[model samples]
Structures are given as structure tokens and as C-alpha cells.
Target: MDARVIILLLFSGVCLTSAGLDKYSFINERKTWFDAQEYCRSRNGDLASARNKEDIILMTDITGWTESWIGLNDLNRETMDLYPNSWRWSTETKSRSGYMNFAPGEPNYANKEEECVDIWTEGTWSDGECSSLLNFVCFSGPSTDKTYHHINLNETWASAKNYCRTYYTDLAMIENEEENQQASSNVTDPAWIGLSRRAWTYSEATNQSFRRWWSYEPDNRSGKQFCASVYKNGFSDMGCTSKLPFLCSDGIARKQSRIKIMIQSNLYLTNQHNKDNMLQQLSASLTRAGQTDFNLSWSTLPQKLDPASLNDDHQ
Candidate 1:
């Protein structure tokens, strides 16, 4: 083969390799401990099975210390595993990997019940109860809500419901096709809603009150359910795990009014301050000009000098 052709082929091969590596990448989101593992498994990967302190730190920085659920769990204590020691991450069906970056004296298996895993700071791992509420991390993919807000930060389903109640109304009860599209467009994370079969019957009588799922029917046989949340493009059954994101809405009119008031207040304050500063400067100039003589008794100036007229030109 010609030398030029050989060089061109080598360059093309390098570009293909780089693109393939990039294709294997994934983004992360908050999820329940169990769900996070399941998510990793479903994707043919596990919650970043890091193997060193550097890897842990890298993940923490990327996830903003937001506390995401990893693949580690001790649900099967039948294997003679302790809390932290028994902690092993499920790679789903991926290859087994190890990342031992633990805190000082960590993986001590403090409590038998503490089987779930989480990353604290850097590569450090800690054992937490699977049921205990904590932020979770899930690999990124299409989600329910399309937009997100800061007010939706770190809240459980129950807590989110209450928050919406005390501040505004109930958890966002998505209704109609328009609302569904709006909800999907505004989700940065999965959010809890008010559509659960645990609290009420999903029969024909109450069908009007609940949001419909886009796909699979949730196993709502048990009545322990009391909340609902948006996932993918439809709603889903979820426990009140502190691992999901939430949604809050401000009616467009109310939000616009508030914004207008804020703008008006800011303008008023700025103008008032400017007026005061101008007055002070004028007063100083008058004093320096030896115009104190003009500060006569009120009787001297029968017609009060209009303060507004006292400009630089008048001075």
C-alpha cells in the first residue's frame, strides 16, 4: 500500500476508537439505593464500581456531593457479611469490580442492619440502611419532568407532599395532555406526585382522580402505597425513598406578579438612593460656595425656594 494511504487509514482508525469510548459514557441522577443498583444493572453497568480514592473523589465532584445510591447492599446476610464488610455492589450483569476507597477505619460493619452503600467525600464509602432515606444516584436517561427548580431539591415523597401543602397546594396533580407535557419538560429528577393506589382505589370510580401510567401497570396489590411520582414519560409506583427529585409549580400569573413587584421595589430603592446622594452633594457644594448666608430665617425668603429647582445651574 502507498505510504500516504497507510497513514490516512491509521488516522481514521484512531478517530473511530475515540468515538466508541465516548459512546459508552452515561450521566447520573438521584435514585433509591435499590433502584440505583437496578438502574445500573438495567444499563449493563453498576453504580460506578470505583476501585480507588481518586475514583471516588472524581465521582463525588461530578455528582456534587448530592448523595447518590450505589450498588452496595447487604440484604443477603446469609453470606456471613457484616455491615460495611458485607457490603458488595451489584454490577447488575456487568463484570465484577472493586473500589476500596473507604474512610478511616470504615467498612467496620458498624451495624448489622446497615447494608446499603453511599459515597461521602472523595473515594470514601459508608454503610447506611437500605430503608433509611438518603439521596440516590442513577445513571442518566430520559426522565419524567423536563424542567427543574431549586425549590424541588432533596425532598422525600411525603415531605414533598407536605411542603407543597404548607406553601401552596398538594403535590403536583398532573392532569390532561398539556399538563403531562409540561411536567415532562420541567423535570431535572424524578418527582413525587399525588397519584398512588395505596391511598385510594384505582377503580372506575376513582380513575378520574389519578394520572394514568404510560406503560407497565405498577404492582399496587398492597395498600402501603400513598404517593406517586413521574418517571420517563409517565407516572410510576415508588416508595417514599429520599432518592428522587421533586416538582413545584408557581402559577404563571402569581410568578409574573411577584417578579413585577420585585422589579418595581428595586427600581424605587435605587432611585431613592440616587436622589439622596444628589441632595447631599448639593448641600456640600452650597456650604463650600459660602452660600450659608442664604440659609436665612424663613422670613427672608417669603416664597420657599423649591428644592427641586436647586440644580447645578441655579448654584
Candidate 2:
């Protein structure tokens, strides 16, 4: 027997299936930071956001040993040409602008490398190199809820930011005095905060604020480092023009189905030539009927079928 598309209207219900949700995708294509972000936004969700250890691990598994672009970037001076040393938070902050608690003579840009800030034990802010291996904080949830956690792992400011975002929030933004106090309250030593100098934003918005680093990263050591890349060694600054394989994530995964066409023809249907001819006829008929978005093929099973039984009304 042969299968064919019948010219009849039918409706059927199988099972409920979701189309999409929050998830990650790994793209093996190599692109610059900006190009990768564009690719992810158009195709998947966004550039991989490994804000915590789990996120990092998941994306790392997708990346293997290759360096890949992530969402975190300090592009203020690159795109806007703003003051190189101006302070900005890691993106996705809950705090309003113009509020600061800098320690006296703090952020002196000492030795010309102190570009990131830290919340000292006294809860006051000080600027240091982005490479400093210090503990960091991650703020999860919304500003109203304001959940914070202190990470004990020593990492540089950039890595700390990535850590918080991958796992929790963006790096603790310290939305207000009370939230700030709450963030530092549980710390036994100085740690990194979400606050840093630059208009850094992830590929997409998220509530996790975590960072990890090696000894010193994102030092702008050559005065050209702007984009961020993940390495087993930790995060480091690279030029946005650098080409590297990047990570991507999807919203979620869902079920997709195809139409099942069953035939009742008594020709030489088992022959490959006959099957191909039937499929071609079905394709032409569908096109003529303005049903251009269908796929026709030979059935993979035995031939006891009914058009009425396929209809939901019959069921």
C-alpha cells in the first residue's frame, strides 16, 4: 500500500507539549564578542551566562578546551570613550546611581591598576586591580527580596562577577544601605562586590551577581583589553576583536511533532520508485492547496489505518 495526502479537513489532539523554556545552548561557531552576542540573541537566548559554578561547569562542558566569549564585558571606554577609570557596577544592579560609600582616599587608582572595587571588612569601598584574588558576593532574586551570599573561593574581580552571575546574581550590587550591611554582615574578610568601573552588561538580564578571578585579570595590561573569555585558569581580558568560540543558551526545550500520513493505496507501494513518486505527488498537491509547509514520506510501520480514526472528533 501507498500513503497519500487526502483533501479533507481533520483536527486531532495528541498530548500537550511545551515549545520552549530557560536553558543553555552551545554554539561552536567562532565570532568576536559583539558578533557572538548578536548570534545568540537572534538564534538562541544569549551568550552563555555562567554566573555560578554550576553554570560555568555546564557551559564549560559545552566548550571543551577552547576559549569562549561570555556575556560580561567592560565596554564603557570602548564604546562611549568615557573616562577609563570611572566606576560602574557589573550590570543588573538594583542600586540607584550617585550613592557611594567610598573609604577616604579610596579608589585612588593606586599604581594605575585599581579599577575594580571591594567592600572592606568595615563595609566601606576601596578600589583595587581587577586581578585581586578576593572573596566575592552574589545577589540573587529581586531588589525587594535582596538575597545575598558570600563566596569563599578566592578569585579576581572579573571571575567573581562571572561566578555570581553564573550561580546567583550579577555580583552583589548592594542596592541600599540595609542591603549593603546585610551583604557584608556575614563576611569574615574583604570580598568583591558587583560594583566595578565600566558599563559592563551580560548578554541578557539576570538576577545572579557572582564573580571569580585568578591572581589579576582584566588589568587592561596592554590598554586594549575589553572583552571577557572563560578559561580553566579563570577569566581574563581580551580585545573584542579577538575571535573565539562562544557559548549560547536557549530559553527552554519543548516537544515538536510532525504530521503522520498513512496511505490505503494498493499499487506497488513497497517499491522505492513508487514511494518516491507518491511523495512527489503529495508535495505538488499540497503546494497547489497552499499547504507549502509540510513534509511527506513513507510510513515506518505496518498498514492498518483509518482517516476517521486519526480525527480527534472520532476519538
Candidate 3:
């Protein structure tokens, strides 16, 4: 009589492809934002993230300067914190915050839609809708006399920012009490200032601050313009259901691979149940080791060991 032996085959490791910056493609077909997202994902991509002015330029050039959907959106903002992380100054040089002068019970974030700030009272701030038309203040040079200029123009926050940038340096960046007082001077009503924030972010959640907004864009006039779309001038918030062509971005390159490992085991390797248990154990070990991207599986059949070899091994 001769004894038989089985050698188990295990597939281990995963395929990885490191990616640089995202590469975008213009899909001329019109689809709603959700449909477009699904289509791009089917093609191993997502809606585009125009990370900077240069990227926006490239995207516009590719789309022939047409209105198209991008991945930036604020759909999930209702559940996000309306605190320090979300608020930002329109001016790039302005610090996040140093001096604080908020009207009592200010920034109540009213209905989670008031992402923009305004001078609710003299030298005090309150959150307001970005779409509200109000007088605004502009700033230039430094926090000196006559640096902050009050403009009696009834415009939205985005429009005010653009108006200030076109004429003065930018919207008023009230860093301290003096600047805040200057920004609020002679203002008897709530006015738009440089301080405002939008909850929009890219699908991939990249931490890039680059944005190229069209004048008065992202006004959130309908309060439902949670999705971002690119136009000839720049980007604007749009309703997600609006049908439009979109840009799909290949986030990172990836590939599939397989590696083999031989396991000499005396256990019943032919049992499908045993193989499944082994795979689960291996997967758990890999996950614990911080290698989550890989998958594990066993080959369909085991290699038969030579009779002589099995006898020698049993000796």
C-alpha cells in the first residue's frame, strides 16, 4: 500500500499602483450628478477635482470651455461641524482667527445654511446666508487708517468678495479690534465681509484649497446647489440633479496581481469548508498587520506528492 500526500497552494499579496495627481477626462454625455458619479466609477474614475487654477484651466481647455460637473460638493455638510474647521477667510494671507467679536448667540449656524459671515452689529459677527444681498466692506494694504472701505453695494457674499478684489486688495480681513471697527464703520445694517466659508469638498477628500470661482458664484441661492460645475469663467455650485456633461478623474492607477505560496499540511486540505476557514483566518491576520488592500484565496486543487517522497517524509 502507498500513502498519498497533498500540498496546499495559497495566493498571497496584492497589486498596487502609486498614482500622481489626478488625470481628468471630459464626458460630453449629459447626466445628473449621481448618474455621472456612477458612470465615472464604472470606468474606474470619479467626477473631476479641479485642484488649482492651472487644473481648472486644463479642464476648461479640455471641455472646450463648457459647463460640466465636477466632484466638489457640499451634500454632506448638514452633518458636519460648523465650527473652526469650516470657517475661512476669503483672503489667502489672512489667519484663521486671532481676535473674536461675535454678537451674543452669534454663529448659531442658523439652520446649518448660514455658512457666510456678516457684521450683524457694530464690530460683531454673525453667520448669514451667502445669497443675502447686503452692503459690504473691502480692505487693502494693511490694518491702517482708511484701509477698510465700506461699499454701499447690495451684493451677495461671493459678489462682494469679487468686487473688493477687483478694486481693492480683497474683502476686509479684520484681524483685530481696530480693523473690525473700521470694517463696520458707518454700517447700520448687516454687511458682507471677507470672512465666509463654503462646505464644499472634493469626492476624493483632497486637502487642496485651490478654487477658481466665477463672480457671485456659489451663492447657494436655492440652498440646494450642493454640487459643483465648471463654466467658461470658473466654477459654481449647481443642483445635483441638473443634467450636464461632466469630467471624470482617474484618482490613482491600480492593477491586479496574484502570488503563490506552498503549504505542506497534514490536515484535510481538500475540504472546501476548511479552505474557507483558512482564508478567513489569513485575511484577519493580514488586516491586523495593517495590510488591508490584499486579498487571500486557495487554489482549486492541491498538488499530489510522489509516493516515494511521501513515504520518506513519513519515515
Candidate 4:
């Protein structure tokens, strides 16, 4: 293919197949899961689908603590069977160390509204409502010194986060057993920590069996927690109406297009040199057009093919 046009001049027909490159984009606007789906569709895409670990990492790295929505959900919870399959961190910028210390039988999604988490004495964690007024702990500088400050003033989870950010670093981030113990050492009562759940699917409504759930999540305690949200580590169930940022995937990446042209030259159709030159020129043109990830392939026409049978119409 030339810069302005592609020309084929040979005895037989030549076919070129171009494969698209996949991409995942994080949309910062907050919207309900269904609304997000509509927005993505309007833009010729859909809610992002993490088909594998790489997809998950790519999408997660786009934003921090935004708790972006994914395509997985249990909208048919009443008819279709489901299970706990997700979790997240309160901070988006920091990496999750995969350390968890939930109390046994805890995180039961008490009252079916407990999405925020708190730590009690003995370093055990529990899920509770974000609006619950509780004293929270904040860490100054880094966790290296185990430097944590317990604010006795009662505040909601959101308020506590602001308070901590204004004074100390942020809400205490407990990365491991020792950090969890240190954060809880001075806690005489359950207080807010830097951990929470936002918490599903591809946007195409294709049921995917692959799941990345927290140790204990998707409890579906409310039975109405049918939607799924994503964070750093895993996914978690949330109410469908909850508005949040989301990830959208351009579906064009998975599609491959094929174009066939008739050759008019007397040279043999199997000429490797001609094929190589055509491919190099075509690849260069595509690269100049800012398309680098596409693939190209060739197919030969049948022996009995007639040049007059080829049409200019491209599929």
C-alpha cells in the first residue's frame, strides 16, 4: 500500500489482513454502572473488561482510589447464581501489599451498607458504613518508623480522610502484619484505616468465569449489591446505582479486517521480493499514520481466478 493508495499488479489476487491493537482507557467522570455503560457505548466502546491479569493492571494503574467501575456484575442476582469476588484499597496511588487481617466473621457487610473498613484493638479489621462516626488513625511521613497518630475526635470516614491528609500523611496504610499491629497498638476502639472496598465483568455482557475476589468479599450481604467495582487488588460488589469513575475499552482492537486486490502484472504471484517490498511500504505508511500495532498477512487467490472477477468494492 502506498501513502495515497494501495496498488496490486500481479497475475493472481493478493489479500491483506490487518489486526487491530487493543486499548484500555480510564474515564474519570463518575456515573452509575448502567449510565457508564451507556456513555461507553455512545463513544463506540464499553465498560472495560479485564480478561486477564495484564488487563487488570493496566486499568488499575490509570487512577487511584477512584474505585472505577468494571463490566462484571450480578444484575440477575435473583435468577443467576453469584458469589463474593472482589475487594479494593482506599488509596489508589499506593500499591497494595496484599496484606489483610479481617476478623473472623467480620466484614459481614453489617446492615448491608458497610463498605468502609476500620481496625479494632488486636489489629483485627471490620467493614462498616463510611458515614459511621469513629476516631481514625493517621500516619506521618512513612510507615518505616511505624509512626501513627490516633485522633480521638470522632469523624466520618470521608471526614477522617480529609483530616488526616491535612495534618498527617493520610489515613494509616497497614501493609503487613507488623504495620497492622502498629496501627492498632494504640486503638482502644475501632477506628478508620486506609483500607476500604469499592467494589465485576466485560461490558459485552459476556459471562466470564475468571474472577479476582478478596479473601472474603462479594458477600452480597444486601442481596441488592449486584454491581461490581474495581480497585488496586480485586473486585467487590456494590449497589448498581452508586456513581463512580469507570474504565472503558474500545472494542475495535479485537477485530481483524481483510482486503483483497487483483494483481495485473506479469510477474509470478509467489514473488517473495515483491511481497516483502509491499509489506514494508504498507507498514511504513501505517506507522506514519500513527498505527503501529496492526498486523498484516497475505493470502493467494485460487488458480482459476479471473482478474475481471475482482471488484473495487472493499469490505
Best candidate, TM-score-wise?
4
Best by lDDT: 3
- Output the better candidate (1/2) by lDDT: 2
TM-score of candidate 1 on Cα atoms, chains taken together: 0.21
- lDDT by residue (110-136, candidate 4, tens digit) is 664777789998889888899999999
- Put down candidate 1 lDDT per residue, 121-228, tens digits, no spaces: 232345544444433222111122212122435554445544644543334333244433443343444333332212222211111122444366444425232234
Of 3 and 4, the candidate ahead on TM-score is: 4
Worst 10 residues of 4 by lDDT: 11-20
- For candidate 4, the TM-score is 0.43
lDDT of model number 1:
0.33
Descending-TM-score candidate ranking: 4, 3, 2, 1
Query: Positional deviation of 177 in candidate 4, in angstroms?
Result: 0.8
- lDDT tens digits by residue: candidate 3, 84-193: 43556665432534565778776676876787888855578887999989999887653333377889889999899889878876777777777777778778888888
Cα-based lDDT at residue 204, candidate 1:
11
After aligning candidate 4 to the native by TM-score, how far in Å is the CA of 110 from where it should be? 1.5
